[model samples]
Structure formats: structure tokens, C-alpha cells
Target: MNSNFSLPNQKSKAILERYASSMSTSNAVSFPMVISHGEGCWLTDVDGNKYLDMMAGIAVNTTGYAHPAVVKAVQEQAAKVQHLCFAVFASEPQVALAERLKKHVGQDYRVFFGNSGTEGIEAAMKLARYHTKRPYFIAFTGSFHGRSMGALSLTASVSKYRKGFGNLVPGVFHAPYPQPYKYPRTAEMVLEHLEFLFKHTTPPEEVAGIFVEPIQGEGGYIVPPAGFMQDLRSICDKHGILLVADEVQTGVGRTGQFLASEFDNVQPDIVVLAKGLASGYPISAVMFKEHISTWGAGAHGTTFGGNPVSSAAALATLDILENGAMENARVQGEYLLGRMRALQARVPQLGDVRGRGLMIGLEFVKDPVSKLEHPELRDRVQQLGLEHGLILLGAGSHAIRLAPPLVLTTEDAKYAADTLEKIILEAASH
Candidate 1:
């Protein structure tokens, strides 16, 4: 591995200066590498240095950067017709993409297209309230739905994301999410907490929906206990509350299945998908059971939601995922999990390693027994990864997330595991 290249070389430094001056400070810029382009699982900065990308733009690029199939689909659709307001005119690409979503979901459902995951969350919120005529919603602590007012109201992952944005949308309650690694019987505790909330705080009859992530993404790639999702489904069903699954970071074969909820054999009343749906093209979909399609025309609409080019790109992405990419995620994910667990035996500071498919997290702790979070160590490892020609991102308080592109090869996976082992060993020593 070439670890000698200087980051923020002359060419990249010039662009970084321009970016600092032009862009908003709210944008989180983790590294100094100014990317010029990417192919497969690697990115090239303007300085001509290459880094293996493990975050996949926060799990956005399912097929990786500049996949030929996605490029061709976007080009062909743009050449014919680039934009049409789906609210007014029906586009073929948009209709076709919706049809494809129905098949993957394996249900008779209606799809609403938007430009982002937040928008999909917003749509689901609106639909839930409209269908049930309820004024309240329930979400989990350490869940990230989105940043818009309604979606923000449902998000409880980071305090900074909510700071200064006071008085968000009302009627949203938060319950604890089950983290089995940290606390045993977490599922039972969480379920009891929800019951307490239903009795003491939010009335079950007034609650419109319960929003959850199958595998918590931004909060940490934390997977819930085995029966947690099924329990949630039962709770929602008993109370006539819609169960909304925020699959933004875990969908599109990211978890070795089309939807992470599939692992538990549970189906949500509403499913939100984005991020990897279009290979980084900006598009999201809110799919709900057909029975809940009660809103009339003009109730919710977007001018740029179903862009033809993005829809075509999503269709192509789905085709690739269905063919073999999903299987590859399963195979490589098991391989990576085994490798990391083996390393954990020798590296006592690695408190926990948990994930499904490529959506994995490695948590750092001061000691294995106490499990005190070691955020500093996690941050240092992320920085050192950049120096070693590897790109990684941090999740939750003290965990490094690995949401690499679904196209990651066995060779690349092996290299990533080896490089991470080296970086962790160095970080732990310090």
C-alpha cells in the first residue's frame, strides 16, 4: 500500500480553499481529498491519488461510482426527455420504476417518488396522518429519519442536528431502541418501554405511526435483536398504527436482502427507500400498502420528484442488484464478519462488531469489560485510514461504519479487512 502520498496536494489544496470560502459551514467535510472521479470501489482525488472507498457516500452508491449500466440508462433517458413534472404529466420512466418497486416489495403497493430520503419520510408522515386521521406519531431514540421539520421531529440520533432548530413538529414521541450488544434483553426492555409510553404518554389510539430503522444507520450500524421488528409490527397492528420502516440506508440489497426487514420476516405498512436506490442519483420512494392510498390528488406532489433520468437510473440499479449484486453482498458480508471477529479476539479494545451485509460497524471501547466508549480512538482510526489510502466514516459515538458499495469484490474486501486491522492496531497502541 502506498502511504507516502501527501493529502491535500497543491491541486486539492486550491479547491479546498475555494470550497471553504464558497460552501456553507454546516456541511460536514471529513477529509481534505477533493475527489475528481470514481470507478468501482475506488476514488481518485484531483491530485491523482486513489483511495479505497468503504462508505459509498454514506451507502448511496449501491453499484459504485460511474457504473456503465447506470451511466447508459441516465444518458439514454436524458437524451429522450430529461424532466417532466410528475405532478402534472405521467412519465414512462417514473411509471416503470414504480412498477419495479412493487415487484421487489412483493406486495400490492402504491409508490410516491421524491428527490431524497427526507422527502420520502415527509411523505410517509403525511400519508400516515391522513389515512388514520391521528395526530400523534412514535419514533425511537437514536433514530435518524431526516432533517426537515416533520422528519426532524422523528429523528433523535444527534443533538447537534436538533440544536438551534427549536420547536419542531408536534405530536412525535420517542421510545428507546434495542441495542443488544450494550445491554442484554434490550428487545424486551424496549418493548416494555413502548407499552409504558402507550399507557402513560402517547395514546395508542391517537398515534398515527411508528417509525423505525431495521438497522440503525447514522446512530450506529446497530442491528436490533431477533424479534424486535416482529414485536413492533404486532404493536402497530393491535393499535391500528401504521408501521413505517425507514430503509434509507439499509435498502436496495445493502443488507444482503432487498429490505433489511426481510431478515425478520416482517413487512412494514410503509417503506421508505433512497440513498442507494439510484446509484447516487438523487431520488427516493415512499411505498405504502395499497389500502392506505386514501389521499386525493393534489394532497401531496412535487415538481422535480420523479425526474425521468433519475427513474431510469433507478431502474438500471434495480436490475443489477437483482441479478447478482445482492448475493455478493451476503457472501462478502459473512466473510468480513468472520475476519473482523477473528481480529477482535486479539484486539481487546474492539468492544463489538455488528452489522448485516456491507452495512457494518466496529465499536471502540476503553476496555472490553466496562465498554466505555472511546470516541478519540475511533476518530484517530478514521483519520489514519485516510493516510493509508482508505476512506472510512464514523457512526454513533465511537464506531466506524462500513457501508461500502455493493459491488465490492472479494479481493477488495480482503484488502479492506487487512488494512483496517493494521490501522486499528496502530490506533490502539496510541
Candidate 2:
């Protein structure tokens, strides 16, 4: 903890206490540090403790916190105007951001704005169903789309998010995700299973679409096997079903590309983006191929979807990410992974290290003799990282997620990896 910072003020403490008692307890919190400000790849708490932010607000902040370019863009746009709904009159910032994203993705693309990732997911789902004229969707097990009803119905990660929320939007089916390390099923086997289900169970003609993360974010940052995405694309194409790539956490240079699908060079029919889109401002979007943007004018809309301020922030953030921040992610991400593997050699509990660019996962497993999950040891290691100066987040049932800002430097990555190794060693010894 830095010595220069003061603790949280009485006003802040009171507000937090009130929020805890009055607000819904459904909001699960992991870290306890009261974040006050963020810069680059680091965050400072009210008590003035500076921590290396490896989670990057759950893979947002691609341009890092309070970047000068984004700040200037927001300031300039705010001075002109802040709230101008796109429904009435399309603003320049929103239009520019769309064009920018379109250029990055492809020429024949259109964009729809929303306030969060779930909103974007909802829009994509609606468009898929409307365009295909089908009632069923094919999703993967251990996938996380979002938390809204439509998105929640599509999400198949955990039961807690869906518990008591039934009967959810029906016709959603979960198949095996292409996790080469964990699942014994190969891409062909999984696709064959999917084909079997579509033919025998749901009927391919009745299927609306298939949704996937280019890399599974919440489900341990699972990278699909080679040619897996291509096979899925082919499957969707053959069935005339839409392919929706949920790049919510993997987009914006988190995986060394504007969209993780770019790495495989397979274009999806629709891409859902959020988290890093507007830096810290709340904005998300569903980008669709020109042919699929068939919704009528009154079909769907949101009040704050593309507000000028958020658009400006998004535009500036995009500028920074496109320029050099993303490339940095690739270089530093490899360095971080290398260091982590070295740590793994020393700490046997750190079983697997996976993910691309800055979106990384370190899975903790019990001793090989037992081969079970070591949640107790994982908790201690995570707490030790917090006790030091790093804020590491957990993923899936037994893995730690490291999604630092793309702007993170190699030095910062080294420090975080080294600090994490020391903590894990101490915990393992205990």
C-alpha cells in the first residue's frame, strides 16, 4: 500500500454500507479494494494502494484508464454536445466509430449500439432469430454470453445465474465447447455430436443460430483447437444459420487482434462487442454483415446506446487500440506466458497456462496423485497476490484469469508474473 494515500472518506464508507444493505445481493464481489482511480495497467484504491490490474475491468480498458487521447476526445465532444439520440439524429462520433469498426472488421458491415454486453447479445440473438425464421439456438457448454434474459438463456456456464429464472427462453441447447485440453472430444467429434443433435433432436431447419466466443473467456480462456472455428463456420453456412461471435471479452486487442476471429481469419455473420469498446464508458455494439442487418427501423432501440459522450470515448479508445496498444499486448502477453510457464515448472499446482495475447488463464490443479481441483490452495494464492500489489481474478472452477490492459508494458507484466509466482510458492509451502 502506498503511504501517500488516505483511507476512504466517511461519506464513501456510508454510501458503500447503504448500498450493501439496500441493493440486491445478487451482485457478487471478489476484490475488496475500493478503487478510486486507474492509469495505464494499474489501479489505486481509496487508501492509496496501487495494484497491477491484471483483470482490466474484466477485459475492458483496452486503451488503459484515463488515456489522454480518450480524455481529449470526450472533452471535445462534451463541449459540443453530450446527449443526442441516434434515433432522432445520428451524431458524428457514433457514425465515425461505426465506420472505424466496419473498416477494421470488413467493408460490408453495419453496427448497432447498446449500453452493455448483454444488450449487444440480445440484439444479435434477435437478429439471428428474425433472419433465419427459426426458434432454436445452439450454444456451447461452459460459455458465458451475458446476464440479461435473452443472453442469460444463451449462457451455459453456471447454474447459479439461471437458477429460479426458468422457464427461460426455450429452444436453447448447449453442446461441448472445443476445449482441446480439458474435453476428450475432438472438433470433428463435437461437430458430429452437434450434427446428430440437429438432425435427431432439434432439426437443423429449426435452428436459428450458433453463438461462440472466439476464445472462451469465463470458461478458463479456452482456446479452440485449430480449424475448429472454420468447421463451425462451415456448419452454420450449410444450415443457413447465423454465426454470432461473442467477442465481448476477447475483442479490442485482448487476443492480439481487433476481433479474435481475425486470428483464424474466419468472419462471423455477427460479432457482439463490449467491455473495451468505450474504454470505461458504458457502450456495447452488435456488428453484423450487411446482408443480416435486415431489422426494420422500429424493431429495436435504446436511449443511451450511442450517446455522444460514450461514442467519443469509444472513437478515441479505438484510435489508441488500433495504433500500437494492441501490438504491445502481443509482445507483452508472450513474455507473461513464458514467465508463467517458468513459474509452473517450480509450482506443480499451476497445472495449465493458456490464452492468447493479454487474455490469459492459469489453472490450478491438485497434486497429480489426486488430480482434483485445489480450490483451497487457489484461494490462498489469490489472497496472497492481493496482499501483495497485484489484483488477480479467478475464472471457471479452478483457474486464474489475467486480462491486463493492452497498454501494459513488459516490465509490468514481469512484475505481475514474478509477484504471482512468489505468492503461489508461499501458499504451496504452507
Q: Which numbered prediction scores highest in TM-score against the true structure?
A: 1
Question: Global CA lDDT of candidate 2, please?
Answer: 0.85
lDDT scores of the candidates, listed in order: 0.92, 0.85
**Candidate 1 lDDT, tens digit per residue, 1-430?**
1122236578888887888888887877777778999999999999998989999999999999899999999999989999989987899999999999999896678999999999999999999999999999999999999999999999999989999998999999999899887767578899999999988989999999999999999998999999889999999999999999999999989999999999999899999999999999999999999999999999999989979999999999999999899999888898888888988998889989999999999999999999889999998888889988899888999999998999999999998999999999999998
- Model 1's TM-score against the true structure: 0.98
Q: What TM-score does structure 2 among the candidates reach?
A: 0.95
Among all candidates shown, the one with the greatest lDDT: 1
Candidate 2 lDDT by residue in tens digits, 108-181: 98999999999999999999988888999989988999998999998988898899999888999988897666
Q: Model 1, stretches more than 4 Å misplaced?
A: 1-8
Pairs of colliding residues, candidate 2: none
